[model samples]
Target: MELEGKVVVITGGSSGIGLATARMLLEKGATVVSWSRSRPKISHPDFYFFECDVRHEHSVWAAYEQTEERLRQNISVLINNAGLGIQGALDTMSPKDWLTMMDTNVNGIFYCTRLVLPGMKRMREGHIINVSSIAGIMGSENLTGYCASKFAVRGLSEALYKEVRDYGVKVTCLYPGSTDTGFFDNFEGVTSRENMMQPQDIAATIVHALQSPPNFHHVNIEVRPLMPKGPKSPKKA
Candidate 1:
């Protein structure tokens, strides 16, 4: 879809990949609406920030309602990027941590997608991008809850893609690996940022998917950093 003057709604747009995407889309002339628990730092004439918690259905609905009332436009794109992770072994992971990951990663996407589908169906054209993780594709040692939630996102995206394609709507599942974001701050395992992908790189990929020609669509994109060389040996020692 041509991005000019389009209405794009992004979840978790306060920072990181979502923030980068909002900036990029705005540069292409799209009006950007960001929904998050905290206010985004962006200030643009075409940018609207809505404080929302996507895990709650009512909050998500209210955000959409306000967007329509204020912008007077149906959303042309929906980016489900609000998610959190708590990495740990299954047995050691707290129940609260598990619920938090599931609610934020899986239920949040569901609520936001549910609210946007009706508008997209009415317009008969839209794009939905769900940000999953490499853990969604491959299981990891200490990230059971995180992996489960992401895997659910993958399944949900694929099923929704099949259901919505007939309505001229496209659904894409993005599996990004080891990006240089605060996502690692709460992680329980060791994390290395030696050769991590930048948030802008993922944002560019998302824009590319949205810019696909009318005749084609991208269903899934998996991105990862090249394997970093091992640290040099301590030969002097």
Candidate 2:
């Protein structure tokens, strides 16, 4: 389907890939709505921001209502891009931290997807893109909760494709490796921000998937920097 004039809702649109995707979608003439706790830094006539904490069902419902009422259009695309990262040893991790991560990374997607799906199914046309991560595909040390949440997203993508494809709704799951984002602000051990992929790169890929033929489904996409770390220099003696 053509992107022009389409309405897209992106979660976590305040920054990172979500923000980049919003800008790119607007450039394609698509109406964009950003759902996040913080306000976006940019502005456009076609861009709309809804302060929402997707982890809560009521918040999502309200946001959905406002989006539809304001735009007077059912969403053509829903991007489950909001995510939280809380990494630590399993034993060291607190229950609150674990719940918060799942609430943001998994439940938020769940709440958002459920609210928009009925309309999409009724329209018999829509796209749902869930952003997973490389962690979802591979386990990482001290990242049990994060990995579990991403894996859940991957599972949702897999199941939803089979469940919704017959209704003319396309489902895509993205598994991206380390990117230069605030996701790593509280963590350490990354090789270099310069070596990671940029948000715009992911944004372009998302638009490409959306532009695919109706019969085609990108399904799952896994992207990473070819060289995530530079070659090591000689060590000091």
RMSD of each: 2.6, 2.5
TM-score of each: 0.94, 0.96
- Runs in model 1 with CA error above 4 Å? 188-191, 229-237
Winning candidate number (lDDT): 2
| Per-residue lDDT of candidate 2, residues 1-237 (tens digit) | 798999999999999999999999999999999999998887899999989998899999899989988999889999999998987989999999999989999999999998889889999899999999999999999999999999999998899899999999999999999999999999977667899999999999999999999999999999998878866788999
Best by TM-score: 2
lDDT for predicted candidate 2 compared with the true structure:
0.93
